[model samples]
Target: MTHHTDLLIIGAGILGLSHAYAAAKRGLKVKVFERTATPLGASVRNFGQALVTGQPPGPMLDLARQSRDIWGQWAQLANLQLKRNGSYLFARTEAEEHLLEAFCAGRAEEYGYRVNLLQGAAMNDLYGGQFRHHRAALHGLDDQQLYSREALPALINYLCRELKVEFHFSTLVRDIEPGQLHSTAGSFRGEQIIVCSGHDYQTLLAEQIAELNPQICHLQMLRARPKVDLNLQHALLTGLSCVHYGAFADLPEAAPVQAQILRDVPHLHEHGIHLLISPTPYGELIIGDSHHYGSDPSPFNAEQVDNWMIELAEQTLGCQIQVVERWQGVYGSRGPGPFSFLRAADGVSVALMHTGVGMSVGPAMAERNITELWGEV
Candidate 1:
């Protein structure tokens, strides 16, 4: 027997789920297949931050904003537990402080980032003097932070119960063509098929994605419990983030900041180490991460990397931290651009986010493609 639907989506990650929402709203029968028993993957293993302020500008930034709007709408519709979080990007060095100043002087405000430079007592009031050694902080007040782990499950519930979309869990797609998919559960046929399997380059679109010189990024992440009642008002970022995010990385002031980091701490630079601390709904702080990239990198994580990150977090927060958990996150490399939609000869399509910003940009990307295929939704 064969299962059928109007649209068949593979990989129930953010991209797939977003596509599902787009189609279902248009009154189309949609079915989604996931290899895992639940929605698990990059969609959950992140800061849950709608990182709108740091996008590289132009198309990518626009998509980030649009996706954020859709996320807000869905949060209300799905009753997702969400928080509107701003970010305090603290500067640890003189060059970094200058870069933050430059970022706030023109581009940040011009781009509607609403960045403000705060220092001394004003900064102290924000986080209760967490950053005693930091020079200054630039706060972007419009960023959105989702309860990443819970949002997916709630979204799944909304799709299944409210939207009437069908989900086939633990169903692996062994083969796929234009309108048919052979899976472990059985055969599925549809008028359209979309692949949003994230970094699974081996399973689908192997030839096409491989041709684009793709690489997988292995990042180290952890959760920690603070020793005291710490008020984490915003997502915490450090000087290193200035060079990591496109919004500030390209600024003239950032060049020296990047160079100074490379010259002073080559190890951090080599491992793509940057510190981001986001507070979970349960009040535990999620900290990370260091990026290691290659076709096939070491499966085992380096202990020293964890130690370095913990030590950095401890220093920045002005408190001791008890590390509760640790894990590695895998995502597709940002090859040439932020994301891509590849078309196969048989009219099938693969949508992949090159960076970990899928949670931030997935919905809008799906809306674009779905609208292109079947008109406005």
Candidate 2:
């Protein structure tokens, strides 16, 4: 059998869907194939928080801001459920507090978002005694969170209904056979192809692109159901605790500095501890996670890590939350910045990543790259 599409996208994760939506919006014939029965990869298996604050300055932050807007527009268009819950980063120690102050003061211009400085009784009053150890907190007005699990499925439905994106689920591609795709379902030929494989990089292409410089990390995330009514409206992050939050402390040749920062920031842990205390519209609070890094992620779930996260959440939220669900999300870290846009010999090029932030950056990156490639939109 033979089928032709103007744009063929592999991997129906968020990135693939973003690209497909962009191309279809441009009126291009687009088709997407995914190895899974449902589009459940890192995209759905995340905190679903469209984080805008705490990102370092530069193009990455710009892309994050842009993606947030796109997500908003798409949510409205698709009538998807989006929680505009704002986010807060708390500093537990004097040094951590200072760092938060510096962060709020430093990146205001570039990020175009105001990081409100909350300290002393104000911090304690708003967040309760849970953050009593901290001297300050960085609260961003424009920084909002999302429920990606709901968002992705809704986005997929919108793509099909409005943009006419053809999605082939459970159709695993065995090979990119020249100008054609050999899949479990059948064969598909296209004028152009875009491979959007996330961590399964080796499955899509023959050679590793230098720009990809992808690093893989395995993270554990938990969803919690509180015993009582929880009225948390904002996403929360602890200073000096989560690896992603205190990552700057571990820069190359900066162990001493990292140690000093950790010392000053008592909550900082080397294993990386960040929590998303956002209550879903359904009344479940999602908290997570700890990080484990390697070229290949080990198939192991550490109970100690889960315990540590639960302890952290119980202390922060002032409630003994019940862990209803837990899962692992593998992300491609240390990439050539954002995602890789590759053009292969078969005229099939695509973007790939291993994390959810790819959703936060998808629209701008997809629009820019797809326009450059197909010369249509």
Model 2, 134-183: lDDT tens per residue?
A: 56777766666677778788888999988888889989898885568999
For model 1, residues 1-377, the per-residue Cα lDDT tens digits are 68778898999989999999999999999999999999777788888878777777788788988988898899899999767767788898889989888878778768777677987887776665667678898877667787778899899999999999999999998988888989998998898889988888899868887877777898999999989878675788899988888889989999999899889888999989999988887878989999998886467999999999999899888889999999888888857678888776465888888887888788999999999888985
The parts of candidate 2 lying over 4 Å away from their true place are 124-134, 209-213, 241-257, 260-270, 354-356
**Cα RMSD for candidate 1?**
1.3
Which stretches of model 1 miss by more than 4 angstroms? Answer: none
* Residue 176 local lDDT, model 1: 89
Error of 2 at 343 (Å): 2.0
Candidate topping TM-score: 1
